[model samples]
Target chain A: MTGGYGLLVADLIGVAVFAASGASAGVAKRFDLFGVAFVGFAAALGGGIARDLVIGAVPPLAFADWRYAVTAVLASVAVFWLHPKLHRVRRTVLVLDAAGLGLFTATGTLKALDAGVPPVGACLLGMLTAIGGGLTRDLLTGEIPIVLQRDIYAVVALGGAILVTIGHRLGLTGLGPLVTAAVLMTGLRLLALYRRWSAPVAVP
Target chain B: MTGGYGLLVADLIGVAVFAASGASAGVAKRFDLFGVAFVGFAAALGGGIARDLVIGAVPPLAFADWRYAVTAVLASVAVFWLHPKLHRVRRTVLVLDAAGLGLFTATGTLKALDAGVPPVGACLLGMLTAIGGGLTRDLLTGEIPIVLQRDIYAVVALGGAILVTIGHRLGLTGLGPLVTAAVLMTGLRLLALYRRWSAPVAVP
Candidate 1:
C-alpha cells in the first residue's frame, strides 16, 4: 500500500506545503536562513518522524530518503525568497495547508494500521502525524500551538483518522478509502476555517 | 550494560527529577492537574522515547516498562501538591536536575553505541536524550527552548557524550566510564549554573 506512486506523490505535496508554511512562519519571526531551513524541515517531517518512531520504523523515512529532505528544503528556500509575493495569496496557502493536513492524516493512519497498531492507537497516531509538524513549528517560534489554543484543525484530522481506521477495520484496502478520507478532511478543514469554527477555551 | 541494576536505578532517578521539574513549570504556569501530568510525562520520558525510536528500540522503555511511567507520574503529582514545600529546596532540585542531565547523557550515549551508532552520532543522540525532555516541556508551555536560548545545558550533555564515546574507543568498558562521564557532567552543570555561565547569542 505504501509503495503506491500516487501515495508517494501525495506525501511529497504535503511535505512541500507544510514546509512553505513553516518557512513563512520563520520569516515572520526574522530567523536566519539556517534557522528558517531547520524550522521548515521540522514542520514538514517532524510528524512523520514521530509516527514512524512510535511504530518502530527505525531510522525514520526522513533520514533514509533524501527526497523528503530535499523537497522540504527547496520549498522552504523558495518561501524564504518569495514570501512577499506569496503573501498576496494567503488564501491559497491556507487551502493547501488544509490539503496537506488531510493527506498526512490519511497516510499516517494507513501506515500505523499497516504496522499493526490497534484501531484506537492508529487514530491517535494519525492525528499526531497531522498536527505534530505544525505544533513543532509553532513551539520553535515560541507561539502556543494552534491545535492546543484554537481552531478545528486537529479535530478535522482526527475525523479523517477515524474514517481511515474504520475502513481498515472493515477490510477496505487500497487507496480508495485513503483518498476519500483525505478529501473529506480537506473539505471539512476549509469549511471550518471559512466559518471561523474553533474549539472552546477553558474558562478563566 | 542495559541490564545493570545500577543503570536502571539511575534512569529512574533521572525520570523522576525531570518529571518534577516539568510539573513545577506547569504549576508555575497555572495549568490544571491533567496538563501538569502531561507536561511531567513529556519532560521525563520524551527524550528516552525519542532515543529509543531513533535506535529502533520498539515500544520505547517508557512504554514497555510500567515502572518508568509510574515513577514519572508520581513525581509530577508530588510536585503539583507540594510545590510550596519544594520551593524551599530549589537548590536541591537544581542539583538533582543536573544529575539527571548527566545520567541521561551517559546512558543515552551508551545505548546508542550499543545499537551500533557511530561515535559522532552517538554523541548527538546522547545530547538529545539529555535535553529533549526540557525542550519539549518548555515548548509545550509556549516558551523558547532554554537549550536554544541560553546556558551551557546541552553543551554539558554533549561533553559527557563525547567522553563516553571516547571511552568506548579507548576500549574502556563497563560502568566506570559511564559513571565518570555522568559525574563530570553534573559538576560542570552545577558550576555553570552558579557562575551564571551561558553561551553567547548570535549578534543581529
Candidate 2:
C-alpha cells in the first residue's frame, strides 16, 4: 500500500499484544477491572504517547483516535475472560509479547527519526517505548520492572534500534532493513526466554 | 523584581519542602538509603520532569541542573540521620508536607502556563506536577495512590492551578494569588487528613 495503512495495521496488532500482556499481568497480580484497563492502556500506548508528547505532537494518542481506547478495552476484556483458561499458554503469550515489543521498538525509532531526533536519541526513545509499558506495569504492582532485570530485554530492543538508525542513515531498503531489525529483536528475545537467560542481579 | 527570579526563589523553598516529604515518606515506607534517595528524587522532580519531557525540553532537571540531584540527596541524607530523633515530630512533618504541597501546587501551575499549554490542560498538568511523585511512590509500593483514593488531593491542586491561571489572566499582582491557591489546597488537604476522610473503597 502506498499509504500509512500498512503501518497502522502493525501498530494496532502491537497495541493488542501489549494490552493483552498488561491485562494478563494485572490479573496475575489480583487487580480489579479498572486496574486491568489502566495497565492495558499504559502498556499499549504509554510509549507512543510519551514519544508523541516529547516530539510536541498535540492531543496525544489517548485523545487522537478512539481505536487506541478500543484496543485497550478489548484486550482487558479478553484477559478478564480468557486468562484462567489460558494459564497454560504462558509461552505463547511471551512470544506474542516479543513480537509486539519488536514492532513498537521499530515504530519508536521511525517516529523519533521522523521528528528529527539524533540517531542515538532515536534509539533511546525506541527502547524506552518498547519497555515503558512493562516498567509501569511492574512498578504499579510493587515488583521490580522486568526491563531493569530481565533476559536481554532492553538490550535486544536497543540493538534493533541501533540497526534501524544505521539503516535509515545508510539509505538501506526499507522493508529489508525493518525485517532484519524486527527479526533480530524477536529472535533474541525468544531465545533468551527459552534458554532462561537473565541479567545478573547485582545492585549497581 | 519584574524578573521571575524572585518567584523562582520562593519556588525553590517549596521544592526543598517537597524533598523533605519525599525523603520522609521513603523512610516511613521502610526504604533503605538508596531507596530513600530515589523516592526523594522522584518526589522532587517527577512532576517537573514529566512536564519538561511532555513539552520536549531536552535533558530534564535531574540531568541538566545539579541542584535537583543535590536537593534530593541532601534531603535523603538528612532524613536518614534525623528520622529516629524526629519520631515525635510526626505532626510537624505533616504540617511541613502541607506547606510543601502548597508551594509545589503553585509552582506547577506557573510552570505549565509558562510552557503555553491551554488553560484546562495546563491546570491538569500543574496538578499532576504537584502530586505525581506521591502517586508514583504509593503505586510503586503497592498502595493506592493518595491522589486517587483520598480526599481533596487532585481537587486541591486543580483549584490552585485554576486560581493561578485566572490570576495571571486578570493581571493580578504579586505572589498573593499563588499563595492563596496553595494555602487553599494545603488547608483542605490537612483538613482531610485530620478528619480521617477517605474515598470509598472499590468492591472487586
Candidate 3:
C-alpha cells in the first residue's frame, strides 16, 4: 500500500512539474489561457499517452484517470498566474524538471512491464515517457526539443529506464529497485545540468 | 481481392506523397540523410500510428507491416535525389498533399469503424489520421502547423471524416459513398488552397 501510494505521489508530482514547464513555454509564446492549458496537458500526458498507445493500452491511463488531467490544468493555471516569478527561478524549474524526468522514466518502465512489453521495448517506452511530453510541449511552441538539443536529458532517462527494465526482467519489481533507479536518474540529470554537459550537435 | 489491392494502392500513394513533403521539409532545412528519413517516416506514418494507438491497435500496423516502412523509405530516398526539381513543382506537391489528406482520412475512418469505434470517435480518428502526420512533420521542423495556419486543411479532413463516419453509421459503406467522400474532401482542400483560405488566428 505504501509503495503504491508513493508511486502515485511521484507520478502526480511529475505531472505537475512537466505541466508547469509546458505552461511556461505557452506563456513565453504569449498563448491564450486555453492554449496554455493545451500545452500543459500535452506536456504532462503526451509521453504516457504515446507509450500506452504503443503497448495497446487503450484510453490511456491519463484519460481514464481524471486526477492527471486536473493536475495538469491546475499547474497550467498556476503558471499562468506566476510565470514571471517562475521565470526568475529558472534554476529551480530545471531541478524540478529533472526530478519529474526521473519519476516519469521509472513509472513508465513499470507500466510497460505490467503491460508485458519486452525489456528493450519497455526501456524505450520509459525514456519516451520521460521525454515525449517535453517534446510535444516544445514542438507546439515552435522550439527545438530540448532533449534533442541539450544536456544529458534523454540519455539519463534512457539509462534509468534500462536499469528499471533490467531490474524487472531479473524479478526485481519493488519500491527499492524503483527508488534506486529514480534517484540515480535524478542525480545524473542534475549533475549534468550543473556541470553543463551536452550531447554533441551534428556539424552541418 | 481487387478492393483490397485498390485500398493498398491508395494508402501507398498517400504515404509516398506525405513522405515527399516531409523529405522536402528536411531538405529545405538542410538536414542529414538520417534526419530526412526520420522526417519522411514520421510524416508518412505518424498519423495512422497515432490513430491506431488511440483505438488500442498495439504494435501499430506501420511497425507490423513492413511494406509501409519500405514505402516511406523509398519515398524519402526519391525526395533526397529529386528535391531540387520537386521544389520547383510546388503546386503539384500541394495537389498531391490534398489527395493524401483525403485518402488517409477515408482509410483511417474505415479502420476505426472496423475496430468498432463509435461514429463520432471514428470521425475524429479519421481527421486525426489525416492531420497528425503533417502536424508532427511541421512541428519537428519548427513551423506552425499548416493546418492551423492556412488553407481549409484540417477542416476539410474533418468534414470528410464526418461524412464517411455518418455514411457508415447509416449503412452506406459502399465504395460509392467512400469515393464520393474522398473526392469531395480533395476538392475542398484544393479549393481552399487556391482561394487562400485561412483559419482565424486569435488577436493577441
Candidate 4:
C-alpha cells in the first residue's frame, strides 16, 4: 500500500472536491442546511462507503473514520459561504470534480482487485463507487440518476479501471498507467461535455 | 382476520389516505409528477417494507403485492390533477392522514404478532412500520423526521402495539382490543395536534 504524503494529498483533494460538488447539488435542489450537509456527506464519502460494503468491510466508511464527518461539514460551509462565487467557474469545478472521480475510481478498482474480485466485477465496482454518491443524491432529491443517462460516464470509469488492472498485472505500477487512467477519463469527460456527445434519447 | 367488506374498506382507505398525504407532501416540496408518485409509493408501503426487512422477508411488501404500487400511482394522479382543489382543506387532509396512520399501525402490530416477533420487537416493528415512510421521506429531504419531533408520534404506535401484544397473549382477539388500539392512537394524535405538543429542544 502506498502509505505516504502523496496518498494523503490525493485523498484530501478528493474529499474537498466531492464535498463542494455535493453541497452545490443540494443547494440547486433548494434543500435546507441539513439537506446540504447530507448531500455533501454523500458526495465525499458515498463512493468509499460503497466500496467498503462490497468488499465486506463491516459498518461502512463513516464509522471507520471521523474525518469523513469533518470534511462533510467543510463542504456544507463552502455551500453556505462560497456557492455563488464557486458556481461562476463551471470549468474549474468540473475539472476538480473529475479529478476526484478519477481518484476514487482508481482506488476502488485497486481495492476490489486486491480483495480478489474478478476483473469484470472489480471494474464494475470501481465505476459504481465513482458515481454512486451522485446517483444517490439525485434519487433522494427526487431526480433521475444522471449516470444512467447518456454520457461517457460508466464507460470512462471502466476504461480507467481496465487500464489500471492491466498495468498492475504487468507490474507497471509506476506513475505511468495511474496518470493514463486519470487523464483518459477526465479528458473524455471534458470532451464529451464540450462536444455534446450524448446518446440518442429513447422514445418511451 | 376481519375477513369482510368492512375490513377491506378500512385497508383501502388506509392506502388512499396515506397516498394523499404523500402526494400533498410532494406538492409542498414542488416535486414533478413522477416524484410525487414515488413519494406516494413510499408512504403507502415504506413501513411494511421496513418491517419485512427486519424480519428477514426477502424482497418485501411491494414485490409481494402489485396492488400497493397501483394504489400509490392512482392516489398520485388524484393529488396531481386536483392539487389546487385539494390544497384548500388542509384540515381534511390532516384528518385522513391521521386515520391512515392509525389503521396502518393497527395492522402492523397484528402482522408482527403473527410473524412471531416477541412482544418488544413486535411493538418496535409496529412503530417502525407505521412511521417509517414519513421518517425516510423527511430524512431524504433533509428535514427532521416527524416521528422524532411533534405529535403523538412513536408513542401511540408503541402503546397500541403493547395492547395488541398483550391481548394476543391472553387469547382475546375480539374487536375490543383492535378497536381500542385504533381509537386510543387516533384520539391521542388529534389531541396532541390541538394542544400543540412538541419535544423540548435542547439548548446547545
Give me the candidate number with maximum TM-score: 3
Name the runs in model 2 displaced over 4 angstroms.
A1-99, A112-125, A147-204, B1-10, B25-42, B56-82, B85-87, B117-124, B135-177, B195-203
Off by over 4 Å in 1: A1-3, B1-41, B44-48, B61-135, B143-204
Predicted chain A of model 3: TM-score relative to the true chain A?
A: 0.95
In the order shown, the candidates' DockQ scores are 0.16, 0.10, 0.16, 0.04
Correct interface contacts retained, every candidate: 0.24, 0.09, 0.23, 0.00
TM-score, structure 3 vs. true: 0.63
Residues A17-130 of candidate 4 have per-residue lDDT tens digits of 877777777677655555566567767777777777677653344434445557765766666566777757878888877787787788778778888898888888888778
Better candidate by lDDT, 1 or 2: 1
lDDT comparison, 1 vs 3, better candidate: 1
Please write out the lDDT profile of model 3 over residues A53-83, one tens digit for every residue: 8877778888988999999999999999988
**Could you tell me every candidate's TM-score relative to the true structure?**
0.62, 0.62, 0.63, 0.55
Q: Tens digit of lDDT per residue, candidate 3, span B52-115?
A: 8878777676755667777997898788777767658888888888888998898899889989
**In candidate 2, how many Å is residue A34 off?**
8.9
Which ranges in model 4 have alpha carbons more than 4 Å from their true place?
A: A174-176, A200-204, B1-204
Q: Which ten residues in a row have the lowest lDDT in candidate 2 chain B?
A: B195-204
- Looking at candidate 3, what TM-score does chain B attain? 0.94
Look at candidate 3 and tell me the lDDT of residue B200. 80
When summed lDDT is taken over every stretch of 10 residues in candidate 4 chain B, the lowest stretch is B195-204
In angstroms, the error of model 1 at B96 is 16
Consecutive 10-residue window with the lowest summed lDDT within model 2 chain A: A58-67
- Predicted candidate 1 versus true structure: per-residue lDDT over A1-204, tens digit per residue: 465788888889999999998998999999999889999999999999988889888678999989999999999999999989997989888998999999999989988888877676677679889888998898888786656555788878878898998988899878787788899999999999999987643232
C-alpha lDDT values of all predictions: 0.86, 0.73, 0.83, 0.71
